[model samples]
Target: MSQTLDLSSAPAILFLFGLSGSGKSYVGNLIGELTGCYVYHADDDITDEMILALQEKRPFTNEMRDRYFPIITEKILHLRQHHNFLVVTQAVYKQRHREYLCKNIPNMEMIFIDASDAVISQRLTTRNGGITGASALALRRDFEQPDSNIKVILNEGDKSMLVTQLNNYFSSAQPEKD
Candidate 1:
Protein backbone atom coordinates (compact mmCIF):
# COMPACT_ATOMS: atom_id res chain seq x y z
CA MET A 1 0.00 0.00 0.00
CA SER A 2 1.20 3.50 -0.79
CA GLN A 3 1.27 5.74 2.25
CA THR A 4 0.59 9.43 2.05
CA LEU A 5 1.76 12.22 4.36
CA ASP A 6 0.67 15.79 4.88
CA LEU A 7 3.51 17.89 3.52
CA SER A 8 2.77 20.73 5.90
CA SER A 9 3.14 18.26 8.74
CA ALA A 10 5.92 15.96 7.55
CA PRO A 11 7.83 14.80 4.51
CA ALA A 12 9.93 11.71 5.13
CA ILE A 13 13.21 10.82 6.70
CA LEU A 14 16.40 11.95 4.92
CA PHE A 15 19.19 9.63 6.02
CA LEU A 16 22.59 11.34 5.83
CA PHE A 17 25.89 9.51 6.07
CA GLY A 18 29.59 9.75 5.22
CA LEU A 19 33.02 9.84 6.86
CA SER A 20 33.68 12.08 9.88
CA GLY A 21 33.45 15.81 9.03
CA SER A 22 31.99 15.04 5.61
CA GLY A 23 29.14 17.41 6.59
CA LYS A 24 26.42 14.90 7.50
CA SER A 25 25.33 16.81 10.59
CA TYR A 26 25.77 20.17 8.94
CA VAL A 27 23.64 19.26 5.97
CA GLY A 28 21.12 17.25 7.99
CA ASN A 29 20.40 20.23 10.21
CA LEU A 30 20.29 22.67 7.33
CA ILE A 31 17.94 20.36 5.45
CA GLY A 32 15.72 20.11 8.50
CA GLU A 33 15.78 23.85 9.11
CA LEU A 34 15.13 24.75 5.52
CA THR A 35 12.72 21.88 4.99
CA GLY A 36 10.87 22.22 8.30
CA CYS A 37 11.68 18.70 9.42
CA TYR A 38 12.96 17.27 12.70
CA VAL A 39 16.66 16.39 12.74
CA TYR A 40 17.78 13.26 14.59
CA HIS A 41 21.44 12.43 14.78
CA ALA A 42 22.44 9.17 16.47
CA ASP A 43 25.65 10.72 17.71
CA ASP A 44 23.55 13.32 19.47
CA ASP A 45 20.81 11.06 20.79
CA ILE A 46 22.01 7.49 21.47
CA THR A 47 23.30 7.69 25.00
CA ASP A 48 26.59 6.27 26.24
CA GLU A 49 24.71 3.91 28.54
CA MET A 50 22.77 2.42 25.66
CA ILE A 51 25.87 1.97 23.54
CA LEU A 52 27.66 0.27 26.41
CA ALA A 53 24.69 -1.97 26.98
CA LEU A 54 24.68 -3.00 23.36
CA GLN A 55 28.36 -3.79 23.51
CA GLU A 56 28.44 -5.59 26.85
CA LYS A 57 25.33 -7.74 26.65
CA ARG A 58 24.84 -8.64 23.00
CA PRO A 59 26.53 -7.39 19.86
CA PHE A 60 24.41 -5.76 17.23
CA THR A 61 24.37 -7.66 13.95
CA ASN A 62 22.49 -7.93 10.69
CA GLU A 63 20.31 -10.57 12.34
CA MET A 64 19.36 -7.93 14.85
CA ARG A 65 17.53 -5.92 12.19
CA ASP A 66 14.06 -6.71 13.52
CA ARG A 67 15.35 -5.88 16.97
CA TYR A 68 17.16 -2.56 16.57
CA PHE A 69 15.73 -1.19 13.34
CA PRO A 70 12.28 -1.71 14.77
CA ILE A 71 13.03 0.57 17.69
CA ILE A 72 14.24 3.26 15.30
CA THR A 73 11.55 2.53 12.83
CA GLU A 74 8.82 2.73 15.41
CA LYS A 75 10.12 5.99 16.80
CA ILE A 76 10.44 7.61 13.38
CA LEU A 77 7.08 6.30 12.33
CA HIS A 78 5.62 7.89 15.43
CA LEU A 79 7.20 11.22 14.64
CA ARG A 80 6.31 10.96 10.98
CA GLN A 81 2.73 11.12 12.09
CA HIS A 82 3.21 14.61 13.49
CA HIS A 83 6.20 16.23 11.86
CA ASN A 84 6.93 17.41 8.34
CA PHE A 85 10.03 15.23 8.06
CA LEU A 86 12.72 13.50 10.10
CA VAL A 87 16.37 13.99 9.20
CA VAL A 88 18.67 11.32 10.63
CA THR A 89 22.47 11.33 10.50
CA GLN A 90 24.00 7.99 11.33
CA ALA A 91 26.78 5.84 9.92
CA VAL A 92 24.92 3.05 8.20
CA TYR A 93 27.87 1.57 6.38
CA LYS A 94 26.53 -1.73 5.20
CA GLN A 95 24.29 -2.42 2.24
CA ARG A 96 22.02 -4.43 4.52
CA HIS A 97 21.26 -1.63 6.96
CA ARG A 98 20.70 0.65 4.01
CA GLU A 99 18.27 -1.88 2.63
CA TYR A 100 16.53 -2.15 5.97
CA LEU A 101 16.04 1.61 6.13
CA CYS A 102 14.98 1.73 2.50
CA LYS A 103 12.36 -0.93 3.00
CA ASN A 104 11.10 0.29 6.34
CA ILE A 105 11.04 4.08 6.02
CA PRO A 106 8.01 4.32 3.72
CA ASN A 107 9.37 7.13 1.57
CA MET A 108 12.99 7.36 2.56
CA GLU A 109 15.62 9.28 0.62
CA MET A 110 19.38 9.22 1.06
CA ILE A 111 22.07 11.88 0.65
CA PHE A 112 25.71 10.90 0.75
CA ILE A 113 27.92 13.94 1.36
CA ASP A 114 31.18 12.94 -0.22
CA ALA A 115 34.62 14.49 0.35
CA SER A 116 38.13 13.30 -0.28
CA ASP A 117 39.69 11.36 2.60
CA ALA A 118 42.20 14.16 3.02
CA VAL A 119 39.53 16.80 3.09
CA ILE A 120 37.51 14.88 5.64
CA SER A 121 40.60 14.25 7.73
CA GLN A 122 41.44 17.92 7.72
CA ARG A 123 37.91 19.04 8.48
CA LEU A 124 37.47 16.51 11.26
CA THR A 125 40.66 17.69 12.91
CA THR A 126 39.44 21.27 12.81
CA ARG A 127 35.94 20.40 13.97
CA ASN A 128 36.62 17.73 16.56
CA GLY A 129 39.98 18.70 17.88
CA GLY A 130 39.79 16.22 20.74
CA ILE A 131 39.20 13.19 18.53
CA THR A 132 42.08 10.80 18.18
CA GLY A 133 43.50 9.51 14.91
CA ALA A 134 42.26 6.04 15.83
CA SER A 135 38.69 7.33 15.83
CA ALA A 136 39.15 8.87 12.41
CA LEU A 137 40.74 5.66 11.17
CA ALA A 138 37.74 3.64 12.30
CA LEU A 139 35.46 6.08 10.52
CA ARG A 140 37.48 5.83 7.35
CA ARG A 141 37.51 2.08 7.47
CA ASP A 142 33.80 1.72 8.12
CA PHE A 143 32.16 4.36 5.92
CA GLU A 144 30.63 2.74 2.84
CA GLN A 145 30.49 4.77 -0.31
CA PRO A 146 26.97 5.44 -1.44
CA ASP A 147 25.55 3.71 -4.49
CA SER A 148 23.46 5.07 -7.36
CA ASN A 149 20.36 5.88 -5.34
CA ILE A 150 22.20 8.39 -3.16
CA LYS A 151 22.73 12.02 -4.08
CA VAL A 152 26.37 13.01 -3.80
CA ILE A 153 27.79 16.41 -2.89
CA LEU A 154 31.45 17.36 -2.86
CA ASN A 155 32.63 19.82 -0.18
CA GLU A 156 35.21 21.71 -2.27
CA GLY A 157 35.84 24.06 0.71
CA ASP A 158 32.80 26.30 0.35
CA LYS A 159 30.25 26.07 3.13
CA SER A 160 28.00 28.88 1.92
CA MET A 161 27.87 27.49 -1.59
CA LEU A 162 27.11 24.00 -0.31
CA VAL A 163 24.36 25.33 1.94
CA THR A 164 22.77 27.22 -0.92
CA GLN A 165 22.84 24.14 -3.14
CA LEU A 166 21.34 22.05 -0.33
CA ASN A 167 18.62 24.61 0.39
CA ASN A 168 17.48 24.23 -3.18
CA TYR A 169 17.91 20.44 -3.21
CA PHE A 170 16.05 19.95 0.05
CA SER A 171 13.16 22.23 -0.57
CA SER A 172 10.39 22.41 2.05
CA ALA A 173 8.06 21.45 -0.78
CA GLN A 174 7.03 17.88 -1.44
CA PRO A 175 8.25 15.77 -4.33
CA GLU A 176 6.06 15.48 -7.37
CA LYS A 177 5.87 11.73 -6.95
CA ASP A 178 4.30 12.10 -3.56
Candidate 2:
Protein backbone atom coordinates (compact mmCIF):
# COMPACT_ATOMS: atom_id res chain seq x y z
CA MET A 1 0.00 0.00 0.00
CA SER A 2 1.26 3.47 -0.81
CA GLN A 3 1.34 6.00 2.01
CA THR A 4 0.40 9.60 1.53
CA LEU A 5 2.65 12.38 2.86
CA ASP A 6 0.84 14.42 5.48
CA LEU A 7 2.51 17.77 5.71
CA SER A 8 -0.16 19.10 8.04
CA SER A 9 0.95 16.81 10.83
CA ALA A 10 4.44 18.29 10.78
CA PRO A 11 5.20 20.42 13.80
CA ALA A 12 7.65 23.26 14.04
CA ILE A 13 11.37 22.54 14.38
CA LEU A 14 13.83 23.31 17.10
CA PHE A 15 17.27 24.05 15.72
CA LEU A 16 20.08 22.90 17.97
CA PHE A 17 23.00 25.25 17.41
CA GLY A 18 26.41 24.62 18.89
CA LEU A 19 30.07 23.84 18.36
CA SER A 20 31.45 20.33 17.88
CA GLY A 21 31.99 19.37 21.51
CA SER A 22 29.03 21.25 22.90
CA GLY A 23 26.80 18.20 23.20
CA LYS A 24 24.32 19.07 20.45
CA SER A 25 23.95 15.49 19.28
CA TYR A 26 23.66 14.05 22.77
CA VAL A 27 21.17 16.64 23.88
CA GLY A 28 19.24 16.48 20.64
CA ASN A 29 18.90 12.71 20.99
CA LEU A 30 17.79 13.03 24.58
CA ILE A 31 15.30 15.73 23.69
CA GLY A 32 13.97 13.66 20.82
CA GLU A 33 13.45 10.69 23.06
CA LEU A 34 11.80 12.78 25.71
CA THR A 35 9.51 14.71 23.33
CA GLY A 36 8.83 12.19 20.57
CA CYS A 37 10.58 14.21 17.91
CA TYR A 38 13.05 13.01 15.32
CA VAL A 39 16.60 14.33 15.62
CA TYR A 40 18.92 14.98 12.68
CA HIS A 41 22.59 15.76 13.08
CA ALA A 42 24.17 17.73 10.28
CA ASP A 43 27.41 15.80 10.64
CA ASP A 44 25.56 12.80 9.22
CA ASP A 45 25.60 14.62 5.88
CA ILE A 46 29.37 15.23 5.85
CA THR A 47 30.77 14.62 2.40
CA ASP A 48 33.27 11.84 1.70
CA GLU A 49 35.94 14.39 0.82
CA MET A 50 35.33 16.25 4.06
CA ILE A 51 35.59 13.01 5.99
CA LEU A 52 38.86 12.19 4.26
CA ALA A 53 40.21 15.67 4.94
CA LEU A 54 39.38 15.36 8.61
CA GLN A 55 40.83 11.87 8.77
CA GLU A 56 44.03 13.16 7.13
CA LYS A 57 44.29 15.93 9.76
CA ARG A 58 43.59 18.66 7.23
CA PRO A 59 41.44 21.73 7.86
CA PHE A 60 37.70 21.66 7.10
CA THR A 61 38.07 23.99 4.16
CA ASN A 62 35.62 26.69 3.12
CA GLU A 63 35.01 24.92 -0.16
CA MET A 64 33.72 21.93 1.75
CA ARG A 65 31.47 24.09 3.91
CA ASP A 66 30.12 25.95 0.90
CA ARG A 67 29.44 22.72 -0.93
CA TYR A 68 27.85 20.74 1.91
CA PHE A 69 25.91 23.38 3.82
CA PRO A 70 23.15 23.75 1.24
CA ILE A 71 22.78 20.00 1.09
CA ILE A 72 22.32 19.87 4.83
CA THR A 73 19.81 22.71 4.77
CA GLU A 74 17.88 21.00 2.02
CA LYS A 75 17.69 17.85 4.12
CA ILE A 76 16.38 19.80 7.07
CA LEU A 77 13.77 21.53 4.92
CA HIS A 78 12.64 18.22 3.51
CA LEU A 79 12.53 16.69 6.97
CA ARG A 80 10.43 19.56 8.26
CA GLN A 81 7.75 18.62 5.78
CA HIS A 82 7.50 15.09 7.17
CA HIS A 83 8.26 15.09 10.89
CA ASN A 84 6.02 16.61 13.51
CA PHE A 85 8.92 18.03 15.42
CA LEU A 86 12.56 17.82 14.38
CA VAL A 87 15.59 18.61 16.48
CA VAL A 88 18.37 19.59 14.07
CA THR A 89 21.91 19.75 15.37
CA GLN A 90 24.23 21.91 13.30
CA ALA A 91 27.09 24.33 13.67
CA VAL A 92 25.50 27.29 11.94
CA TYR A 93 28.64 29.42 12.04
CA LYS A 94 27.81 31.41 8.95
CA GLN A 95 25.42 34.33 9.29
CA ARG A 96 24.01 33.77 5.84
CA HIS A 97 23.10 30.22 6.65
CA ARG A 98 21.38 31.35 9.84
CA GLU A 99 19.54 33.98 7.86
CA TYR A 100 18.41 31.44 5.33
CA LEU A 101 17.01 29.16 8.01
CA CYS A 102 15.28 32.00 9.79
CA LYS A 103 13.73 33.23 6.58
CA ASN A 104 12.65 29.93 5.11
CA ILE A 105 11.37 27.76 7.92
CA PRO A 106 8.12 28.45 9.71
CA ASN A 107 8.00 28.49 13.50
CA MET A 108 11.69 27.63 13.63
CA GLU A 109 13.31 28.28 16.97
CA MET A 110 17.06 28.33 17.53
CA ILE A 111 18.43 26.77 20.68
CA PHE A 112 22.07 27.43 21.46
CA ILE A 113 23.62 24.71 23.56
CA ASP A 114 26.93 25.79 25.01
CA ALA A 115 29.50 24.80 27.60
CA SER A 116 32.81 26.18 28.77
CA ASP A 117 35.97 25.73 26.72
CA ALA A 118 37.40 23.51 29.42
CA VAL A 119 34.23 21.39 29.45
CA ILE A 120 34.20 21.17 25.68
CA SER A 121 37.86 20.13 25.65
CA GLN A 122 37.14 17.41 28.17
CA ARG A 123 34.18 16.13 26.21
CA LEU A 124 36.15 16.13 22.95
CA THR A 125 39.02 14.27 24.56
CA THR A 126 36.72 11.68 26.03
CA ARG A 127 34.71 11.33 22.83
CA ASN A 128 37.66 10.47 20.54
CA GLY A 129 40.18 9.02 23.02
CA GLY A 130 42.22 12.20 22.47
CA ILE A 131 43.05 11.25 18.87
CA THR A 132 41.68 14.43 17.33
CA GLY A 133 42.90 16.90 19.94
CA ALA A 134 44.33 19.32 17.40
CA SER A 135 41.16 19.35 15.33
CA ALA A 136 39.11 19.82 18.46
CA LEU A 137 41.24 22.76 19.43
CA ALA A 138 40.87 24.24 15.95
CA LEU A 139 37.12 23.78 16.14
CA ARG A 140 37.05 25.55 19.47
CA ARG A 141 39.02 28.41 17.98
CA ASP A 142 36.70 28.68 15.01
CA PHE A 143 33.51 28.40 17.07
CA GLU A 144 31.20 31.37 16.97
CA GLN A 145 28.68 31.92 19.73
CA PRO A 146 25.36 32.79 18.17
CA ASP A 147 23.60 35.95 19.27
CA SER A 148 20.45 36.10 21.37
CA ASN A 149 17.40 36.59 19.23
CA ILE A 150 14.26 34.53 19.52
CA LYS A 151 16.48 31.70 20.71
CA VAL A 152 16.97 29.77 23.91
CA ILE A 153 20.36 29.30 25.60
CA LEU A 154 20.95 26.07 27.45
CA ASN A 155 24.17 25.60 29.41
CA GLU A 156 23.82 25.21 33.15
CA GLY A 157 22.49 21.69 33.79
CA ASP A 158 22.71 18.00 33.08
CA LYS A 159 21.38 16.72 29.75
CA SER A 160 18.45 14.82 31.20
CA MET A 161 17.31 17.73 33.32
CA LEU A 162 17.74 20.15 30.42
CA VAL A 163 15.90 17.81 28.13
CA THR A 164 13.00 17.61 30.53
CA GLN A 165 12.97 21.36 30.86
CA LEU A 166 12.97 21.79 27.10
CA ASN A 167 10.25 19.22 26.71
CA ASN A 168 8.10 21.11 29.17
CA TYR A 169 8.86 24.40 27.47
CA PHE A 170 8.02 23.19 24.00
CA SER A 171 4.95 21.37 25.15
CA SER A 172 3.38 24.66 26.05
CA ALA A 173 5.20 26.81 23.53
CA GLN A 174 4.71 24.93 20.28
CA PRO A 175 1.38 25.04 18.58
CA GLU A 176 -0.71 21.91 18.32
CA LYS A 177 -0.33 19.96 15.09
CA ASP A 178 -3.34 19.78 12.80
Off by over 4 Å in 1: 1-11, 47-68, 128-132, 167-178
Q: What is the lDDT of residue 119 in candidate 2?
A: 79
Model 2 residue 44 CA deviation in Å:
0.6
Model 2, range 47-153, lDDT digits (tens) per residue?
99877876776666667777887788789889978987788888776666677777777777777777777877777778844227676565556556576564564
Q: How good is model 2 by TM-score?
A: 0.78
Worst window of 10 by summed lDDT in candidate 2 = 1-10
lDDT of 1 by residue, 42-158 (tens): 654444544553445433344444455557766777877887667888666566677778888887776777788787777766774433445656546645567886777676655
lDDT of 1 at 150: 70
Q: Which residue ranges in model 2 land beyond 4 Å of their true spot? A: 1-11, 128-131, 164-178
Cα deviation of 168, candidate 2, in Å? 7.4
List the pairs of residues colliding in candidate 1.
9-83, 9-84, 10-83, 10-84, 11-84
